[model samples]
Target: MRGTEPPVTPDGRYIVVRGRLWRKANPALDAEARQTLVADLMKARRAVRDAVRIRDDMSLRQARRSVNDAKVALGERGPVWWTDGAPDLNRRLARNTIYAEWYAALPEQP
Candidate 1:
């Protein structure tokens, strides 16, 4: 997560961060569409932080929903975007899954 770009899986389905697998945004999305979604996502994330700071339960819920919606639209959550029948592995530690060998071989990040 500290790097400009995390190490992505060989198949491009996920990016490895802090030894965990996170689903990537859909590659099929056009640049404009992806940019727009990412903007909305960042806005929602800021709202989440603000809500937590102020202890506003209602705003927190709404902001979280916005975050979830953006993530879904970005193909990072809810359902698998790939058609290859692979199981969703979002949030799994890379060392515990099929990517263990590959993950082990990556150069250590500072």
Candidate 2:
């Protein structure tokens, strides 16, 4: 993601929005920061109970911050991540469905 351009669809319809393609002004730092923030958001979501019980304003704010961090990082790359890797990564991710299944089956550690 740091050095590679993103792919575009053959029909130029869709692009891979996530993974290593996303970048920012400072791509390396921003990408890692975004990953950290997303991971934190996931942690917060998992820590909560039912929907009604998850209403912690502070944590919600933190999730917003994480979203902003990721958004800012993506902006820094100036669309390079989206436009460049669409074809190759999209096919790769689609074909690698089994990897996703395996990943989803992994146990989460608290």
Best by TM-score: 1
Off by over 4 Å in 2: 1-53, 76-110
Model 1 ranges off by over 4 Å: 1-3
How accurate locally, in lDDT, is each candidate?
0.95, 0.43
Per-residue lDDT of candidate 2, residues 4-68 (tens digit): 54443334333333422222233344667767755754554554333326787666666555555
Residue-wise C-alpha lDDT for candidate 1, range 1-110, written one tens digit per residue: 44478999999999988899999999999999999999999999999999999999999999999999999999999888899999999999999999999999999955
Question: Highest lDDT: which candidate?
Answer: 1
Model 1 lDDT, residue 19, Cα: 91
Worst 10 residues of 1 by lDDT: 1-10
- Could you give the C-alpha RMSD of every candidate to the true structure, in order shown? 1.1, 11.2
